[model samples]
Target: MALSLWRSVFGGSTNAPEDGGVAFWSSPERAGWLTKQGEYIKTWRRRWFVLKHGKLFWFKNSVVTRASIPRGVIPVASCLTVKGAEDTLNRAFAFEISTRAETMYFIADSEKEKEEWINSIGRSIVQQSRCLADAEVVDYGSSEKR
Candidate 1:
């Protein structure tokens, strides 16, 4: 219940910043936050009343697919957003692609898999930039009010 509340306020887990670490929020939408757990977005699962932003949205994705990554160096590729890059305590914050129209997947596993994907024309995966391309930043100046 409380977990659901936090989710409502923060939009979704995918929108949270990874660098912040893991944090549980009562009002996750606020900026310049510093709480008991102000790092990665928490599920808010540890409280009562089910805060406005605490629910399924906080969990991001719940999909689990058969992946060869679990057997090799990267033992959880299908479950990762950027399997080959960083390893989060939970997988889903990275930049992963799973389109079905003309789909091809990349899992971080044995050296051969990584090498093959990199050397191949498609199915290539790499570390992604952390900045939003065209997003507007809310300046801290108090000169104007919206």
Candidate 2:
């Protein structure tokens, strides 16, 4: 039973990355129901949002039973930022994620849910930025920052 639960959350064995890198982190930081703005129209649709690997993925239904093929994905890379959109949208439960290319707005079921998503995504963005900064090489030979 425990093993099955573990496999359902992560995977049994075939959950490795395509390039043979490390496997995806087993658990999601946050997963819940949220409404997403459509691309072409102003229509909003409900989806199961999963935050993993600094990316937000939407599923049609449950994350466990489904094959985890995301209907849509919002990559929260280091450059991305998450903020409340109550002022812009005039909705208490609204938040937006902006990247270099585009900005996506989402509405949570409640104010609490919205706050949780914002904090989780904000932490993810900070974590990604730290990873990027750590991977960068500091030039001691040059006169930059010392």
Candidate 3:
């Protein structure tokens, strides 16, 4: 199974970088990715909002299963969870994490637009068996803390 470095950055795995902004990490089956907690096992799920045609097409970051979300138009960013591959594919929770920059997609433009789009879809994307607990939060330094 192939995982991305984003999972590691989110504390999903600590295995260092490999190439193309992508890294290899070992995630679990059921849902979240697996990380070693001092020899013990810790499961963490990543989540993100996907935007297609200026709307919330889906929300997943772990092991989500669904058909390939077609990039109907230029995406304007997203706030969905990110994760490694294999476990997330097909599962509504898993998303093949990537370091390709393009994969760092979040929000449809503004959080407001995203919320509106999501709400328009019935606000069911955030339902259980869909939305997973976020990975440990971190400061990536983007919103002006530079």
Candidate topping TM-score:
2
What would you estimate as the lDDT of candidate 1? Answer: 0.24
In order, candidate lDDTs are 0.24, 0.68, 0.29
Give me the runs in candidate 1 sitting further than 4 Å from their true place: 1-80, 84-96, 99-103, 106-112, 115-129, 133-135, 143-146
Clashes of 2: 0
**For residues 1-146, could you state the per-residue lDDT of candidate 3 as single tens digits?**
11322342224432322211211122211111221111122333233333322222222343233332211211122233343332433222222222234332222333444344334333322442143434445566756753
Query: What's the CA RMSD of model 1 in angstroms?
Result: 17.5
TM-score of each: 0.18, 0.74, 0.17
lDDT of 2 by residue, 1-146 (tens): 22232233335433322222212234778888988887668788898877777666666786443334455555566236798998988877999988665667889989899999999999989987888888996877887673
Q: What C-alpha lDDT does candidate 2 achieve relative to the native structure? A: 0.68
Whichever of 2 and 3 has more lDDT, that candidate is 2
Model 3 Cα shift for residue 20 (angstroms): 30
Between the candidate structures 2 and 3, which one is better when assessed by TM-score? 2
Alpha-carbon error at 52 in model 3, in Å?
11
Better of 1 and 2 by lDDT: 2
Model 3 root mean square deviation, Cα atoms: 17.2
What is the C-alpha lDDT profile of model 1 across 61-131, one tens digit per residue? 22212210110011111212323322432222221223222112223334454433333212222211112
Q: In every candidate, how many clashes are there? A: 26, 0, 25
